[model samples]
Target: MNEIDILKKIASNLTERKSTAALSNYEVLCNNIAFSHDLFEKGIVYLEFIIDHLKSIFNDRLSLKGDFRENECLHPFISVIPSLLLNDLEVIKKLSAYTPPDNRHGITIDNVSLLHRGFMNYNNLATATRQLIDSLVTDSYQLQLLDPKEFNYHVLLSLNSFEKYATKSIRQGLFNQEIEDALLEFRKLNFKDWKNSSITKCQHITFSNKVDHLFTNLNLVASEDIKFKNEINNLFKFSSEFTHIGYISTFFTSQAGSQVVFGSEKSPYLPSTENFSELKYQILETCINFIHKVYLPSLSSCVSKIFSSSQELVIEKHISNLVSLLKEGIKTRNNSYYFFVCSSLIGSQRIIDLPCLCGHLNKWRPPHSNSDLFCTGCGSSYNILAIEGDPGYIITGNGPVKVIGSEAPDFQDLPKEKQQEMLIKVAEFNANGSGN
Candidate 1:
């Protein structure tokens, strides 16, 4: 049977089971399907069931008003809506278009206000979904799936649907032209270039810049509370760094081979496939958590702060929420020892030059180098040894030197005099005839 049919059967069977094991399996199956394809309505049904099943897990009775109020509910609900089938799209589109003021059919203003707050909660889901889609499509280094052509086709199809819904809901289009242009450009993108490109760079910069503008606008509206302005600015700066530069730098370092900056006066090395994959997963999780737990909450609270009266309780609540989110984010960062472990694993790939280090030029060298010369390719010095009665010199090294990879120091950027001076230093060092 197709995935949908199977999910339907599982959902049907779930209603018949009273056992916790069966319910847990149903939840896992639902989550897995939700993770893969958001279009699955059956997955949604299953999730609703899971929520009801787990209702007792919550404490405060007021907090148990609905499945949506729980923070944990946000991730799963957001996950399932995007890949949902076209027929099911209307339900999600309706959810997105929900506005509180209209909900009471022109009744009391208090009811309208309550509905508006309800809409905000739903809007958070939409924003979360958009963020998740962006994350999945633009992984670290901005690489799409191994097959860009296939991924772009899917993205284009989704963009068309997105535009239609956006136009209908917003009463005006925002991303229609931008989405079309991006799709067109995507078609022409070279896979290699896309792989190397920093997908987060432009988006991160835009978001960071937007935060600055947001603060500026807020400062104009906010009362002349210097302390409040300062706090908001600090929060903006922290969010900008967390989203843009800090996370990107961590991801780039994890992916772009090792560095010589830490521990044991040794050079950095390329990471193993497993090590790189693990780090990549950790970085991805960190980014996802930051967006969900930190960025979204901060933006939502800031919006409320900007619009609502400056009641001390409301202000304190928002500020406390921001602080709590940041603390959680900080705690998630891996310890220094983890970084050292990753670096040590990376260092094992260092290159060791042989013959050139021993003052012998007659020995055969690797194809990238000639004779017993120092190999610029791998950043290692070799030596050539003329063993008694040997037909030719043997090439060897005192120890393995770390490979510098493609981003080694650029000699071409240096002035000619400086370049010559560096070469002279290298020559003198080699003439001294010591591996040390």
Candidate 2:
């Protein structure tokens, strides 16, 4: 069934069971749904702000010069946010499907399964949120400091993780010899110094030697207090448990009601009402904080850093204006105006590479949707077909000049130096176009 239908079914059944446990699940379910929707809506708002700002800064830089060097750095991180947001949505859906194991009969097994799924979804949601925060910070570094040592460290950790897991699977007979040999060959160069060490050596180095580096890289890596290290450790520890053992342990334990169902003593176990409620509320709070405190602020910083190179003061002014509008909107209850102003301020400029006459690349999302064009900065709309035309005019000394498509230029028509410069610009634009 669809998510809406499932939500409706839960709501209808909530009233049927007035027992304390059943009532608590209903309340928690309602809260979970509400919290998820709030994040989803806010994510939409933040995403619009982020993408529009990226486009604006890109086009603004494009207008001043033919070569925009920073575009490549912005693409990878900007492309990461939407998928993370999608992960949040999926977690929300699972939370909505979960029901308390109050009726320990025909529905008990399904409810238990749903609860386990919710835990797994929450783990994924948390991971994605953390990664999004990290990516934004990396984006900021690319713009301001241009240091990539930490970025490469993350890359090494990721590759090492894959190698470690692949080797483990091979040992467990989960991968054939050919696959094992391929993985070993891929790791050969990386393993030169630590030839006898386990493949997880990089992972160990990241956690043990790079804690300070991580904190320095991103404010969200840990809490901004004395207990930051503890918080980071705890977060990773809990996430690991949730990912590997928590779901399976749920079936074997009788201590609490938080979504486990396996046991030899299987006399239809369920967590205590209080314990179950606690777990549910904890997940809700984490999701909300991740969105409000971690994700949005880091994303804003990333955008500001990328655009601040040429017009730092102007970027700050626009952000201040957006904050003021948001406060006023909250006071006057004009959410539409607030969001519009936010979009206008952030997306004041359009992407240099997109093909819309308004010169704005508006709302290109929901991958399957054919109708993803609606400009908030300018009251103009276009379809995917519009992408074929020239990008909007750029401010030039002579006046605003329309940008000719990069393809319009013949490479050999220019001096050798200019030709090389043109090739670099085209390559940068293509990288930005891919945005990943």
Candidate 3:
């Protein structure tokens, strides 16, 4: 049957209360239109019309089941329609002020509650769509329009809180010294068992699946937008260098008993913490722009074509309100969460050391030494067996300063005295350096 005729028949069935036949027709319509973007958009309009009609018919009749399925014929129709409506409503609410006049229009709370049990069904549907999109991207479906670079960038940005927290932990010395030492122990762990660890395996599987899905979608839409294609290609290059090659190099170097050189010559695109933060901000801005300039407008245009001309203003206003709300929501939500996580990870500990001008007797040690005799606070090295008892040494390198144990005082019980002595030494070092 023609689309208009089929829609008319479905509406008639609803009016006549022929639930069985109406549902069957609805199911057929839904199934046929499910994959076609154009058909899906039209179907939503038809469903919205049917919902309004049903509300008008049964508004005073309290006998109808509260479930969406009672009025809708198909299972998927009942399941999906409420969410679409709610999603539409949420976008509207977000875009527009819940001011009294606008609030007075559209479905009332009482009706909405009775229809979908108080919860907006659209959120569930949007979540489902997100999941489906994720799955499609992971499966490498060429027909999908998603860009993995943009998608991954979004996901990483979403996890900004996690990254911030991790960095904070490093800066604050929050980790136990023993835990830091455990790196040596971790190296000795069996490779077979380590490789098969649940976390590692799961991460590998998830990443691989996502990459596959992303590539498939990329291939399908490669010809649609040259800019998008170029972005995707750059993203792939970054991922290859940052994740694949960088990870391999780190693993081998760490295993080889050497420091892993991160963000090195081989992986030029791998961002440092500062770089990652900046890139994340840029990506978020770009996504927001894309959504505002491209996605929302395109969807609105399609919606306008399907709906009544008179309703255009209302729909457009609703969409604008929603886009604004989403932008604000993302910013507020991410900022607060990111700050909390990062602060927790990187505490407020300040590291202080003696300046070079201090002429305090300073003991020095070779750049590479294994001893707990270094006082990080004063940048002094101590030797217990010096002829004068304890000889203090000061670091004199352009790199990070380290304390040597030989220069530290043996007066453990005289904490105040030891601090006073260190201050005097610092004064002398400073004076001598100033003269030169």
TM-score against native, each model:
0.20, 0.40, 0.23
TM-score of 1: 0.20
lDDT of 3: 0.32
Task: Report the lDDT tens digits of candidate 2 across residue range 42-98.
Answer: 333333443444455554543222222445643443344344445444543444344
- Whole-model lDDT values for every prediction: 0.32, 0.39, 0.32
TM-score of model 3 (CA atoms):
0.23
Q: Model 2 off-target regions past 4 Å? A: 1-40, 63-146, 156-224, 227-232, 246-274, 290-294, 309-436
Candidate 3 segments exceeding 4 Å error: 1-225, 232-271, 320-436
Candidates ranked, most accurate by TM-score first: 2, 3, 1
Please, what are the lDDT tens digits per residue for candidate 3 over residues 72-118?
A: 42222223323434445343233222111111124442333221211
- The alpha-carbon deviation from the true structure for residue 172 of candidate 3, after best TM-score superposition, in angstroms, is 46
